[model samples]
Target: MKNLSLQWRITLMTALLIGATCIFMNVLIGYSGRHYMDSIGSHITGYEETGGEDPDFFDPRRERLDQELTIVIHGAQESFIATNWYITAAAALLGGVLAYFLSGHALKPLRTFAAQVEKVQPNNLTDTKIPEAVLPEFRQFSRSFNQMLDRLDSGFAAQRQFTGNAAHELRTPLSLMQAQLELFSAEHPEVSPETADFLRLLREQTERMTQMTKTLLEMSELRTVPCTERIEIGPMVEEIFTDLAPLAERKNITLKATGDGTMTGSDTLLYRLLYNLTENAIRYNRPDGTVHIAVAYEASCLHITVTDTGCGIPQPYRESIFQPFFRVDKSRSRENGGVGLGLSLAWEIVALHGGEIRVAESSEKGTTIAVSFPTDASAD
Candidate 1:
């Protein structure tokens, strides 16, 4: 009973109720019939001696009348018990069917609310909310859920604005510091080896900070960016591969692009999306490793896969790889000049285009990332 679904529970309870009512009615009828029969017998016995008949006389006709009356009442009792059993069974069956459907009908609003909730995403947070329901309880639930969504929308907006502002503010100071450090290093050509090493380290840190700030700004603005241009997948892949070929060549890694697909999106953002993925593939790969890019259309959706023969991501880290500032191998990431934001930025770009990005496969051998986007020209 505890494990039963709502509909089943409702049906069972309804059937039990109907059966109980029928049993109670049957018991009342039987009791009343027996009492009436006893009263009539008493009256019949009293009347038998009313017409100057012997009080103790065994009258054959009177005996026959009494016997017939007893038979008739006993037969009626038996008929009623049998008939009531059939009626109770039929009522229980009917009640179960009605309860099953009635429960489903009553829960339809909750099902609709769940479906709407599933479609809500950060990019479209403001536009999605639970619609009003007719039932009072469901209506209240919808109202509360909409209020929660409003708070979430406000919080996300504030976070994005703050990130953008902070990133913008940090960039100017970083640029000025980099220029000042370069001027000081050039002016002090006779500095000790230790001072030169310190200055070089300072310059490197400043550059890293500048890159991080730029990535942060890009991530912050992704929510407000709109994708309106139609891009051919084949050409875009070719161009991205060409642009990143130098980086791949430095490690003797091979870059290959194949298949044809197209989607509607911002070209700049899409470029960044592919660039980050390809760049990571190149940066993390072993010498002479291969990076493969493929795009294809399936069921009105475009599928893009990037596979790299690099040191694969661990299973535990794969889930958090797209999170900002999360790195699987911190030391390796630093050596590769990674600030742990490439995949995070890629994820944001994919979300902005209303697509999905996921690590399709990973192991000690290598890793593969698959992205899917609606092929519809109007998808955003």
Candidate 2:
């Protein structure tokens, strides 16, 4: 009972009520019927015992008539009880069936409402609402849900605005600091060793901050980017490979790509998704390790897979790796000049295109990240 759905619960409760009523009615009717038959039989039999019938009938005849009356009354009572039991059982079962179907029909609107809610997303929340013309029972609920969505949409919009503003504001100070440090270093190349080292650290930190801000701004803007462009995979993969060739060479990692597919999405965002995956593969890989990317369109979904023979991510961290500032090995990520936002931005890009990304498989040997963009995202 605790685990049953609302519809089933309603059906069962109704069935139980109907069954109880039927049982009570059957019992009452059976008792009255048995009593009436016995009273009538006794009344007719009593006349004979009082000597109301002919004496020629004799005492043996009287006994026989009374015996027949007793037999008939008891038999009718037993048959009446049996019939009531059968009818009660039938009524209970029939009530349960009708209740089950009726409950399902009554709950259909709720199911449809749930499905529509499931389709709502952050980017598509503006103007998202359930119709007010729904069933009376759901009308108030629908209006309240829409109002909640409105509040949520407004909140998200404000957050995005804040992010964009904050990122832009930080970029200026970071650029200024970087530029001043460089100019000062150029002017005084003969500074003390300690001072020079300190300046270099400042420059590095400032540049890292700048890049972080840029990534943040891009993430916030992703929602506004249109995903209607038809982007091809082969050429884009080649471009990413070309851009990262120097880094791959420095790390002694091999790069490979195969298969081509086209998907409808923001060209820039799709490129970032590919580039981030490929870059991470190369940056974290073992010396002489290999990175392979494959693209395919199958079963109406565009799939992209990036496999790398790297220091494999642990099982638990696979899901966490996409979070902003999340790193499997903080020191190693820093050494790779990563501030831990590449994969985060990749995740944002995928979401903007209404796609899915996940670590397909991972172990001590290697890891494969799979991405899929199913169907057209422009429906939003």
Candidate 3:
């Protein structure tokens, strides 16, 4: 909706064109005037210098007449030049003003088209009908933009459908597993302690699998959820710290959070983003190391940084770390009980909120991952 964006570059070009034309026109007019004056002055001076009407007679009185005639010709030439100069100056001024206004009027349709495009929301993105623009040449461009919107809307719909179906399918098996484990445990109290312990571990693993499946399904659903809610980011960060403190303590790691501010986004998504970030920091930290969480409101974004004194990610693999199923050290990932989707989910959540998440810095010293969200977006 800005009045003077790069889309109006054509306006500047039009002004330049008008300026060049004015300069060229003035130059041509001046050249013609000079030619006319030279020809007329030479003929009159020649006639006066010759006493006879013939081409070759010379006299003292005739020479004096030639001087007078030259003066008069020069005065007339000056008057003609001055008049033309005024006319040309007025024409140049008028042209410049006319060009400026004309350029703005010509670009008005483009501005309206862009404003319409900006008004599109995710829910209505599937609609392919773009508002008609005044300029015929822009119709094709409008069609292409609407087509892209349709494809994106279809993509998000598909993702949502897949997640819904997958969650339904997984719930049945998860329920059966829980029932079987409960029956087995209830019927086997008379068994040896080791056998009981084994059954307990089996039950635990099954529950873990259920939790993982549910988290994965939620992560998939988060992709399609419109992030239009307002969030008190400071409180959200506090809640994450409270939730993960016990887990960090179990690993002999100290987890801490600092800074307080509000940001815009879905509360569920913001929690997920912070959870993944903090969990990674704690999981990767060395024994008894410190994991730091900081939140600060910057110029236009709310920044959350998670730093850990862990086995830092190598420089070569930083770019790939946010990709699903990507692990710098596969064995290390297994040791940390990671499926390599945590950061990927975090990345998607950040992107859904029109923000960004990345490993801002990494080395043997430590690694710092920053997740940022726009401060203007409301958190749901």
Name the candidate that leads on lDDT: 2
Name the lDDT value of residue 343 in candidate 1: 95
Candidate 2: list runs displaced more than 4 Å: 39-53, 59-76, 185-192, 297-300, 378-380
- Number of the candidate with higher lDDT, 1 or 2: 2
Look at candidate 3 and give me any clashing residue pairs. Answer: 229-378, 229-379, 229-380, 230-378, 230-379, 231-379, 264-377, 265-379
Using TM-score as the measure, name the better of candidate 1 and candidate 3: 1
lDDT of 1: 0.86
In model 2, which residue pairs have backbone atoms overlapping below 3 Å? none
Query: What pairs collide in candidate 1?
Result: none
213-311 per-residue lDDT for model 2 (tens digits): 999999889877887897788999999999999999998999999988877888998988899999999998989999999988767788889999987
Model 3 alpha-carbon drift over 4 Å, by segment: 1-31, 46-134, 178-209, 223-231, 315-319, 378-380
Candidate 1, 236-353: lDDT as tens digits: 8889889988898899999988888767889889899999999999998889999999988777788999999998988888889999999988998888888999999999888878
Quote the lDDT for 16 in model 1.
89
* TM value for model 3: 0.70
Worst 10 residues of 2 by lDDT: 371-380
lDDT of 2 at 323: 92
